[model samples]
Target: MSQLRSMYPPIEPYSAGTLDVGEGYRVYYERVGTPGAKPAVFLHGGPGGGLSPEHRRLFDPNRYDVMLFDQRGCGQSTPYAGLEANTTWHLVSDIERLRALAGVDKWLVFGGSWGSTLALAYAETHPDRVSELVLRGVYTVTKAELQWYYQFGVSEIFPEKWEKFQAPIPLSERGDMIAAYRSRLTGDDRATQLEAAKAWAIWEGETITLLPNPAFSTSFGDDQFALAFARLENHYFVHDCWLEDGQLLRNAHRLRGIPGAIVHGRYDMPCPARYAYALHRAWPDAAFHLVEGAGHAWSEPGILDQLVRATDRFATAP
Candidate 1:
C-alpha cells in the first residue's frame, strides 16, 4: 500500500491581519504560501476552534495560496468568546466577506466537522462562487445530529466522560443537554461558565478519536480554548445552527456540480456515517470516502491522508 499522506511541514503565516467585519467584530485572517497562487480557503472546526498553524500545512506551500481565519469570536477575533451576531448565516456572510477580501472570483472551500456545515451553508448560498469543495467529518446540524453528540448516542459510548459532561447540570436539566449547557454557557456566573466549558469541551476531546490521543484530548481542557469551544458549539447546536431541519441535505443539489470530496470516518461518533452517506447520495458528483478505523478528527491518519489528497488534487484545478 502507498504511504498515507500527512501535513506539509509547519510554516508560519506570511501575512496576517484583522478585518473589521462589522457588528463589533474583527475577524482575524492569515495568508500562507505564495500570495495569489492558486486561491483556496480553510475553514476551521468548532464554530469557535479557530485556526492553528497546522492548518497552514494542509496545502502545498509552493502551489496554493491559502487563507485561514478565526470566525467571529475565535482566535484573534475580537471580544474573545462573545456570541453576539454569531450564527450560521453570520459565518456564511463572513466567508463571503473574506472571499471578496481575497480578491479572487472563486477559490477552493475546505472545511471539516462544524467547518463542513459552514462550507455547505456558504456553498449553497453562493454556489456560483466556489471553485471546489472539500468536506470532512460531515456534520449536518440536524436535531438528530445534535442529540447524538450531546444527549444520548455518544453518552452511552463514553459513560465516564458523559458523567463529567453531565455533572455540570443537575438531573432535571439533563433532559435537554444543549439547552442545559446553553443556559450556563451564556449565564453571568463566570465560575459556572468556566466549569461547564471545561467539562463540555473535554467531552468532545475525549470521544473524538477511535483510540486515545492524550495531547489532542488534553488541549480541549485548556481554560481559554474550552470556554470559547463549548460556548460557540452549544450556542450553535441549541439554535440548530439557525438551519431548517435537513436543510443542508435538502440543498445538496446546490453542490451537485461543485466538484467536491466528502470524507467521513466510519466510526465517527459525533457525526454518523449515515449523514455522510445521505450527502453522498444527494451530491453524487463529489467523491465520497469512508475511512476505516478512524473517528472524527482531521488529525487521524486515515482522515488526514484523505484531506491532504483532496487539497493536493485541487491545488491546481482549472
Candidate 2:
C-alpha cells in the first residue's frame, strides 16, 4: 500500500550516443542523472516499444546513473521498424555492448512486460553483470501465455475490444490471430501495414488498462512507431520470443542469488498476475507484491507506486 514517490524533476541526459552493435543494428542510448552514480538501465517493454523521457524519472537524479535505450529498430535506432537481426538474444547482447560502452561493471536493471522477459534473459545470461532487478507486469512469453491473451482468455473479459482486434482478420485466420496479423504487419504494402498496425496497436491499448485510459492515445499515431510495435511484437510472439518452451522459467535457477522485486497488477489482461506469481515462486528469494485494482499499464497509479518504491529500495541497498 505504499504510494509512489514523486518522480525526479525532468532532467536532460548528460550524454547520448548510438552504439553500433553490428548486424546492421545501432542502438540509441542516453545516460541521465548523476554522471558518476549507481548505473541503472531501463529496459523498455514491447519488443519494439522504444524509450521515452518519462522512463528516466523513476530514479533519483542525485543518486542513480540512469540509462535508457531504444532496442534494435526502435525509437531513435537507425532502421525504423526494421526487423532484420532482431531477436531476444540480439537484445541481450546489445545490452552488454551498451554496458561496456558506458564503462559500468554492474548496474541495476528495470523492466516490465516484455522488458521483464528481456531482463530475466539478460540477467540469467550474465548474472555477474546485474547488481539487482526490479520487474513489473512480468511476462515469460510462453506459448500458452500468448494464447491466453490473444487466442481466447482476455477476449472473454474484453470481448468488444477483442472483436476489433479480430475484425482485421478473416474468419479462416481467426484461429490464429498472431499469424494473421503478422502477414499484414510485415507485408510489402505500406498502406496495408499501417492499417494493420493501428488495429493491432489499438487492441492492445484498449485492453492494457483495467479501467479505460482516457489519456491513453493510440501509439500508432506515428506510423513508424505503430508499424514497429505491431510488427516486432508479432514477430517475437510468432517465434515464441525465440525461446524454448518454458525456457525463462526453466532457467530461473540462474536468478537464485540476484536481489529482485516483482510488482504485478491483480488484473493485468496482457500478462495475467499468475505469470508473476509463478516467476516469484521460481525465484523464491525475490520479493513480490500484487497490486489490486490495477491492470497491465505501468501508468496505473497503484502499479506505478509499487514499481517506483521497488526501484527506490534497490537504489539504497548495499
Candidate 3:
C-alpha cells in the first residue's frame, strides 16, 4: 500500500459562523488558514457525514484558505437529523450560499464519497465557479450505485456485515433497505430510531475500509451523530439523491474545461471502482487513479496519498 502524505498540522478555524439558509435551516461554516490565501471548499461525505477537525488538515493552511461546514442537519448544524426540505439540491445551493458569504468568487472543490457526488452536482450547476476538483472514493449516487451499496452489490462481499445491516429489517423489505431503514430512522419511538441509527451507521463504518478500523467503529455510538448520519443517508438514498437518473455523468459536459483529479480505492465495496471509471470515461480530462490495497475510507493510506498529491498539484497550478 502506498503511504499517505503527511497531513497538515491540526488547526482550528480562524473564523466561524452559521448562515440561516431559510426554512429553519442554518449551516455551520468555518474558515481556516491565511484568510487571503487561494480559497478552497471541502465537501464532506455521507450527505450527513459533515466535517471534522482532521478534514481541515487535507489542505495546506498557508497555500489555501479552507472552508468546511456541517451541511443542513449534520455536524454542528441545527435541527440535528432533520430531513424536511433537505435534498441534494438544497446542499448544492447551500454551497453557493456559503461561498457568497465567505466572499470567494471561485474555489477548488475537494470532496470524497457523497462529497464527490455533491461536488459534481455543484460543479455541473455552476461550473464557472469551480477552479478545480479533487475527489476521492468517487460516488455519484446513481440508481445502480445505490442498489449496489444498499440493495445488492455490497452484500456479495460483506455477507456477514450485510446480515447485521439487514437484521433490523424484515426479509420482504430487504429489497428496499433504504426504505426500511428510513421507516425506523424516522419512526416516532426514540429507542427504535436510535437502535436502527446505530445499525445503519455501524454497518457502513465497518465496511468502509479494506480492514477493520476500531477508531471508526466508535463513532457509531454517538446518538446525535448516528441519528443524523443514518437518517440523512437513508433519506437521500430513498430519494435516489434527488437527481435525474445518471445525472452526474449525463451532465459531465459541463465540466469540459474544469481540471479534476479522481482518486478511488480499487477495493471500495460500498462504492465500487466502476463508478469512478464511468465518470472518467465521461470526463476524460479529469485524471483518474485507482489506488491498490484500499477501500472507501479516505484514511486508507494509498487513497490518502493520491488525494494529497492531487491537492498539492492543484496548489501549484496556474
Candidate 4:
C-alpha cells in the first residue's frame, strides 16, 4: 500500500496584503512557500468560511508558492459578511484580478466544498489560466445537492443534529429551512439572528465530522464566525449559488486537459460522494480518490492524505 501523506509544516506568509476588488470590497490575501516556486492558489470553503493559518500548511513550503485569500466579506475583508456583489461570478472575477496582480499567467487551483464549486466556475470561465485543479469534498450547490444536505438526506443521518438545526425556526417554516433561516439571518432582530446563526452554523459543524469533535463544533458557535458563516451560507444556498442545475458537472469538460485530482470522504455530510463520482466520470483525466472512514473537513486523515499527495505530485508539473 502507498503511504498516506500529511500536511506540510506550519509556516507564515512571506508576503500578505489586501486587494481592492471593487464594490468597496478588499480581499485579504497572503503568499507562502518559496518566493518563485510553482504557483498555486488555495480557495477556502463555506462560501463564508475564511482563510485560516492551517490552510497554509496544505502545500510544501519549498516546492510551492501558494496564494491563500479570504473571499469577499469574510475574514479581514471589508464590510464583514456583507452580501452585495458577492456572487459566484464576482468571486471568479476577483480570482482573475488576483492572478493578474500576482503576474502569474496560470496557477494551480485548490478548493474544497463550496470552494470546489467556485473553482469549477473559475476554471470553466478561464480554462487557460488553470494549469491544474485539486478539489476536496466537492460540492456543486445544486438544488438537489443543497436539498440533500440542508433539507433531507443528511437530516436522516443525524437526527439529533438536525433537531438542533431546526430549533431556531418554528415548525411551520420547517418546509423551507433555508428560507426560514434567511429571514432571521438577514433580519433586524439581532438576538434572533444570532440564535439562528449559531444553530445554523453549529448544525454544519456538528454533522461534517465523522466523529464527535467538540472543539471543531464550538468554533462554529463563535459570535462573529457564526454570523458570517450562517448568513453567507444561507444566502448562497437560497440562491442556489447562482448556478444552473448541474452546471459544474455539465461543465466538467472545461477542466479535462488540466491535470487534476478529486478527493472526497465517503461520509462527507455537506457534500455527497456521488457528485465527486459524477465529476470523475465527466473529467476522466483527473485522478479520483474516494477516501475511506472520513468526513467533509479537510483535517480528516484519509482526505488530507490524498490532498497532500495531490499537491506533492503536481509540485513540479506544468
Model 1 clashing residue pairs (backbone) = none
Task: List candidate 4 stretches off by more than 4 Å.
Answer: none
TM-score of each: 0.99, 0.97, 0.97, 0.99
Q: Alpha carbon lDDT of residue 247, candidate 3? A: 86
lDDT of 3 by residue, 40-142 (tens): 9999999799898989888888888888999889999988888999999999999999899879889999999999999999999999999999889888887
Give candidate 2 misplaced runs (Cα > 4 Å): 1-3
User: On TM-score, who's better, 3 or 4?
Assistant: 4
- How many residue pairs clash (N, CA or C atoms closer than 3 angstroms) in each of the candidate models, in the order given? 0, 0, 0, 0
Candidate 4 C-alpha lDDT tens digits along 28-141: 999999988999999999889999999999998999998999998899888899999888899999999999988899999999988999999999999999999999999988
Better candidate by TM-score, 1 or 2: 1
Q: Write the per-residue lDDT of candidate 1 for residues 190-296, one digit (tens) a residue.
A: 99999999999989998889998899768999999999998998888888899999999999888767899999999999999999999999999889999999999
Name the lDDT value of residue 227 in candidate 3.
89
- Candidate 4 — worst ten consecutive residues by lDDT sum? 1-10
Query: lDDT of each model, Cα atoms only?
Result: 0.92, 0.88, 0.89, 0.91
Candidate 3 matches the true fold with a TM-score of: 0.97
Query: Which is better, 2 or 3, measured by lDDT?
Result: 3
